[model samples]
Target: MATAPPPKSQHVGAAVAEKATSHVAQYSPDEKWAERSRKAMQDAITNPPADAYAGRSVKNTGNLAIAFRSLNEILVRNKVRQTVRMTERHEKKGTKRRRLQSERWRKQFSNEVRKKVQLVIKIRNRGA
Candidate 1:
């Protein structure tokens, strides 16, 4: 059997009305409410719209830092990948040959540190 939906109440009962009256009365002299209102007024005075800084000439400086970090990570990973590939290729030739190949890769990786430094300099110059 289907149950009928309960009808909505049309009346605001005396108890509910009394409670709401008390709440409004409490709000008048409430320190907490006054503090909240004060803070809200201060925020309205200070904060501009979210889009206020959207197209301004001011510098971000964050993007450049992120770019430099990402580039450094890519360069390091690529160096490692290439070294691994070369080492695998040399392994078929001989163990000593693989060791020599890895040493060459290590020397190549040493130069990558300079590239990371250059990237940082470029990022600092851009200021994003």
Candidate 2:
């Protein structure tokens, strides 16, 4: 039986979203979604939509900073994906489940440590 793929949810991470909280996204997604995401992210960084800077002047330093900041976010997202893929290799079916569970634990623990130091405050209230 064929399985339908999960719906894609776009997440735009801020500077400290990684430290503040773990992203509740799927791991080892379908090949098509992964390929599409990689392409979209690259296109986003290189060919941002016109309205992204509608009223802002590129000549202004702050406006430029915003652009750079967004660029950094894309880089960070790619970095996280790379970090996962860096260690990834073929595993026996039994071990694959354990490996993913460990990844979840690591992500959970990371947030706990950051929370201890009160870095959770860095997360912005978006679209408010």
Q: How much lDDT does each candidate structure score?
A: 0.69, 0.67
lDDT of 1 by residue, 58-121 (tens): 3447788776666656657557557667667534557768777898999888879779989999
Q: Give the TM-score of candidate 1.
A: 0.23
TM-score of each: 0.23, 0.30
Residue-level lDDT of model 2, residues 1-128, one tens digit each, is 99776544434454357546666555565876888999999999997778733433334356877876766666576575566685687668778788789999999999999886564445443322
* Clash number for candidate 2: 0
lDDT (Cα) of model 1: 0.69
* Candidate 1 ranges beyond 4 A from true positions: 1-93
lDDT of 2 at 41: 100
- In model 1, what is the error at residue 113, expressed in angstroms? 3.4
